[model samples]
Target: MAKKAAVLMLILFVASLLAGCWNRKELNELGIAVAAGVDMEEGGRYRLTVQVVDPGQVASQQGGNGGAPATLYTSEGDTIFEAARRITQISPRKIYFSHLRLFLIGESLAKRGIGQMLDLLSRDHEFRTDFYLVVTKGTTALGTLKIMTPLEPVPANKLFSSLETSEENWSPSLSVTLDELIDNLTSQGKHPVLTGLVITGDPQMGQTKKNIANIYTPTQLQYSGLAVFKKDKLIGWLDEKESRGYHQIHKGVKSSVVFIPCPEGGKVAVEYIRGKTNVKGKVVQGQPRIDIQVEIEGNIGAVGCKKLDITDTATIAKLEKEVEARIIDFVEETIDKAQTKYRVDIFGFGEVVRRADPKAWKAMKNNWDEEYFTHLPVAIRADFVIRRIGTISDSFLNQTKE
Candidate 1:
């Protein structure tokens, strides 16, 4: 009888413990934040801009009030956490960040350094590591977030989806999550890079409902060049070409289009179907060297040139050579810029060397970026093969072009 009573008591206790949800927040008392922006205020203060979804408006079928899907609230304090906490003074409900998609660091804040902001984000259990981090180009984080985007009613969602799609189809832009950024920042060899966001057109109209009402959005957000960083500080910017080169060198590019000048004038557009890049690092006679070999397979997307017979194997071979040269140029220019202009090792060659020869890395680790990396000898080789030339071998452009 006693044994039966103990078993019953244990069962009751276990059930009690399992049924309750500890520290549970009811949906009614939570304000779900989808995007957050940080900008440095003049007095060394921090401004936190949060974009919260308007659930009812977002669900509206008839485009609710010109599709104002998200609402922005700004607050200022001495620190990021303080600014975040101050947001509650204006916001009715307690801010929740599990749904956060984007984190924007303003140019001022990014240049000043993001290590402090990252500390708060890393320590706080509220902020997820998966959210992307972007630096606003030539504007505050708030300005970048204020502009309403077309198609995706919510500006935050637009930025998130646009970056994801852009990275796949475009080579210049890259998407970096908080975790990835932290890893790169913490790593000894590699520094971090983030896609820069720019607000185009008039800023005043971007915040209004009229921004999305018209077919032509007077104001829009664009993912521009990659923001190069020496540690957490923004050192400089890489143009679209340089950014593409970075992508190719680091194997960040999945697929993209390359336009090559044709032999007979005009340009030939090619779709990169498959690409492979191999970066090897080694110490030869006490000097470090890097070898980058790239192989690409692509198909003719468009031929804007006059009189090119892509059907001939010789023609395809010549086109392949042009493609290879272009890729090689991209790789070489990116390496040269990294060595001379930036003088930072964003390519992570140090890590490659470390893995290759630990003893050598230990000696060069301290002066890798400024000394060794700045004058690192690099060799690049690219090979390209022309796949199927679209639906038709040659463009009708050849038939009519004079």
Candidate 2:
């Protein structure tokens, strides 16, 4: 009987503690941030824009049609922390960041510096590390958060899907998360790249506010090229073609399509199936010299040659050589521009030199950006193999021998 009485007291004690929590807030009392954008404001201040979810509408989706989707709020301050605090001025309820799916930085802000903006994200305990980070080109960071995506019920979900698709089709367009960005910033060997976005529209529509579109993408955010950075500051932008070449040389480029001009003066599209780049770094006279070998195999998708037969070994071999030459030209041009014009090691060649010849890198580590990368000797060789000619073996224009 004494044991039974003790057990009854324990149940009452648990019930009392569970019923009286003062920190609890009603669901409608908080504004959940779906996405965040950071940009450089005038007078050396920073601007923060947040896309807040409407819980009432989001939760009632099963029975009712989606309403207003998400609302965007903007705030400006000297720092990211201060900017976030200023958001409370416009926000009716407490701003919660537990559901943030994407973070965008304007090109101007990225060029100025992202380390300061990202500091708050890393130190904050409420933010998750999986949020996608993108660089907005020709658009303000705040503007990127305002555009609504079609098909997706929520704008944040659409942004997430855009990044995911880039990874599967064009690997150079791989998505970078908060955790990965932080890691690249801390690592001395490599510099992180972010996807670029732009706003486009019909000028006559008069609804220019909804014109935001990632240019590389026909529909949504595009992870097309690398945003070359000197440490944390963005140096320059790489075009889509240049970005693909950079991916082939330094980053992970699983599959990509290249349009090579045929002998008959039209376009021949070849889609890559397997690609591998091998780099060899050698030290000579206290300088770094690197050799890059790219091997790719793909099948021909279309042929514009009027007289050439794809099944012919000679014709196929010549086509393969021409494709290899085009890839080499593209790769060399990108590297030359990056090294000579931008002077940033966004291609990660510095990492290769460091890993290959530690002694040379150690001696040249202090002045790598200025001295080493500028004068570093780089040799690139490309080899392409046409594995298959699709379903039709010969070109339609080829004359058949009876």
For all predicted structures, in order, the TM-scores are 0.96, 0.84
Candidate 1: misplaced stretches above 4 Å? 64-67
Model 1 CA lDDT for position 191: 90
What would the per-residue lDDT of candidate 1 be over residues 62-143, giving only the tens digit for each residue? 8667647788899999998899889888999899998999999999999889999999998999888888999999999988
Clashes of 1: 0
Per-residue lDDT over 1-402 for candidate 2, one digit per residue giving the tens place of the 0 to 100 score: 999999999999988988966787777788989888988976889898998887666667562463566788898898888989998998998889978998888888998999987888988988989888889887787766666555665678887887777655665565788888887777665677777876555322312324333333233433556677778999888887777777777654567777777665787788888878998888887878989999989889888767766778997798788888878887888888888888867667777888888877888777777888887788988889989899988776566463
Q: Pick the candidate with the highest TM-score.
A: 1
What's the lDDT for all of these models? 0.88, 0.77
Provide backbone clash counts, one per model.
0, 0
Which TM-score value belongs to model 2? 0.84
Highest lDDT scorer: 1
**Where does candidate 2 clash, by residue pair?**
none
* Candidate 2 weakest lDDT stretch, 10 residues: 202-211
